[model samples]
Target: MEQYKRKIALTNARFYAYHGYYHEEQMLGNEFFLDIICFVSNPTLNTDDNLVKTINYEELYRIAKEEMAQPKKLLETVVDNILNSIKVNFHEVNEIEVSLRKSNPPFGGDAATAEVSLYWQSGT
Candidate 1:
């Protein structure tokens, strides 16, 4: 038995997509960032050198990229969607988290960015 395994993550992934509440935001688009983490439990993590034995990071990035392309009004919604997508694809993961950030929101002021995050763990 290999016990538990290490986590896999894609951090600071940047995308320019039309996603926001205001009309201009949907039209003009803006910079968006994402961070996804998946904690996997696999018995072969230490023994097998095969990609199939553990979480494929490229597949994880693909899920986030696809979800980010869809325009949504709220970051929370986007985060939720990403989480669900990951859950659907990587059903064996022990824990997962997704975070989305919108850079320099239109409100002006000195606010750096608007961010939202969603997290999940197996068994309540």
Candidate 2:
């Protein structure tokens, strides 16, 4: 007997939205990058080339976009929302990893970006 696994990923998704704690930050808006990876238990479903067997990238993008559109003071909150949405909607996903980056953050120095990463697994 053998076990099979599959991973689907969406990387470098860019969005400009109002997500910050400062008043100026919200008003000014900023660019954000999102990366997501979903793990599946059945690898054969991927080989079958069936849409129903795999997570839809478009749907995943839409979920992320919708969540990002909402203004949240913390990037961690945004990541949590996205992660929960994916897990609820796509039960086939056994594990998920999310990375979010805010570019050119207003640190008033030479900071390029600020990022946060989150991982979630079912039943844990």
Candidate 3:
């Protein structure tokens, strides 16, 4: 199963979201970077010229957009939504890894950003 699986990376996919532990953050909103790696159980993607043989990137983007539109207090929640959305939408997807970074977090510190990452499989 591992050998036949393929990884598709979506890097620095940007979105504007109202997700934070603070009230100001929810009001002002912020820029978010999402990186996703989808493990598809299709070796044919390596050789098949047709995109139909692999997961569609457009559909993935739509899923991300919809998930981000809903506000959440924690990045973990967002990651969960993304993973579950993908798993539910695409049956061929066996596993997923999602990283969400909030640029310029509200924390009054020298840190540039705060981020959370989650890895999920279809089943235990």
Candidate 4:
């Protein structure tokens, strides 16, 4: 049997939001970069290209945007929320990968950006 797989991805989606552990970081806000990829199993090839048959990346962006707007103490929480929201709405997706990054993290000295990534699979 031949297996068909499709990947829908949104990369480097930037947002300025208040999500941090410290009060100062939350109050000041920071730039966040998000990357997400959705995997879909195509049991049968679609002769006709239908938007409904595939994941809508625009909708994914909206979900990420909405989730990022809500303040949280950790990037892990944000990543989990985004993953869960997608799973709930897009039941067709078999797997999901999300990475959230906070630029110019506090702690000084040409600091590196803080990042958290999550991978999810159906029924796991």
Candidate 5:
């Protein structure tokens, strides 16, 4: 079997929104970083052409931005939305992994950041 992999890593994808359980946190939105990895089946390798045969990363970025803009109580929910959005929008993508990180959370702690990642593949 032939496999074509194309990875689009967007680091430090900053999104400011209220997404915490605490009252103060929910009222005051914070910045979050999102990293997305999309494993797609490249058609250009077989056809030797770049005519709508590959995934449109620009569109993916738009989708991610839209999803990230929405405020959610849990990072898990946001990650899930990102993965599901990609899966539905891009059919060529066989698998996707989304990592959402909240940098310098309101909760004062030793940890620098808090993150949640979700992996979703085709079928079950």
Candidate 6:
């Protein structure tokens, strides 16, 4: 039998946070959006409809929320922290992808948002 990977995702999680390089950006705060995807092995194992057999999305949300609550200077740091936290908490996860977006970034242009996407695989 061929083995396949399963993915669980949380999309468009919105938060207001104080995360940026500039002091004003921190004090004033901005809207941040997160989309997280987690990959696991043997998705069919959860066919029994047991929560324990699958990744709990609420748990992921809680972890992201907790991590986002603390301010950080760069989105890269925030992404790293989230990825590390998820990996530590869920050993079954094989890979994780995160997309973080900040609205109205300080650059002097009509940019709607600034975004970062990061991918992490276990044992790499």
Best by lDDT: 4
Among all windows of 10 consecutive residues in model 5, the one with the lowest summed lDDT is 42-51
**Count of backbone collisions within predicted model 5:** 0
lDDT of 3 by residue, 25-65 (tens): 89999999998899876457446588888888888888899
Each candidate structure's TM-score, on Cα atoms with residue i matched to residue i, is 0.91, 0.93, 0.88, 0.93, 0.83, 0.93
Residue 42 of model 1, lDDT score:
54
Query: Looking at model 1, which ten-residue stretch has the lowest summed lDDT?
Result: 40-49
lDDT per residue as tens, model 5, 3-110: 667665556677887877678877887778888888765545636666476666677778888887777788888889988988888777877888988877877866
lDDT per residue (tens digit) for residues 1-124 in model 4: 7778888999999999999999998999999999999998863455698778788899999999999999999999999999999999999899999999999999894857999999998883
The residue-level lDDT of candidate 4 at 115 comes to 92
- Deviation from native of the Cα of residue 110 in model 2, angstroms: 2.2
What clash pairs does model 2 have?
A: none
* Weakest ten-residue segment in model 2 by summed lDDT: 41-50
Tell me which of candidates 1 and 3 scores higher on TM-score: 1
lDDT of every model, 2 decimals: 0.88, 0.91, 0.87, 0.93, 0.78, 0.91
Clashes of each: 0, 0, 0, 0, 0, 0
Superposition error at 92 for model 2 (Å):
0.8
Please give the lDDT score at residue 4 for candidate 4. Answer: 86
**RMSD versus native structure for model 1:** 1.9
lDDT (C-alpha) at residue 83 in model 5: 86
Candidate 5 stretches with Cα past 4 Å from truth are 46-51
RMSD, model 5, all Cα superposed?
2.5
| Predicted candidate 2 versus true structure: per-residue lDDT over 7-115, tens digit per residue | 8889999999999989888999999999999998855545666798778989999999999999999999999999999999998899999999999889875759899
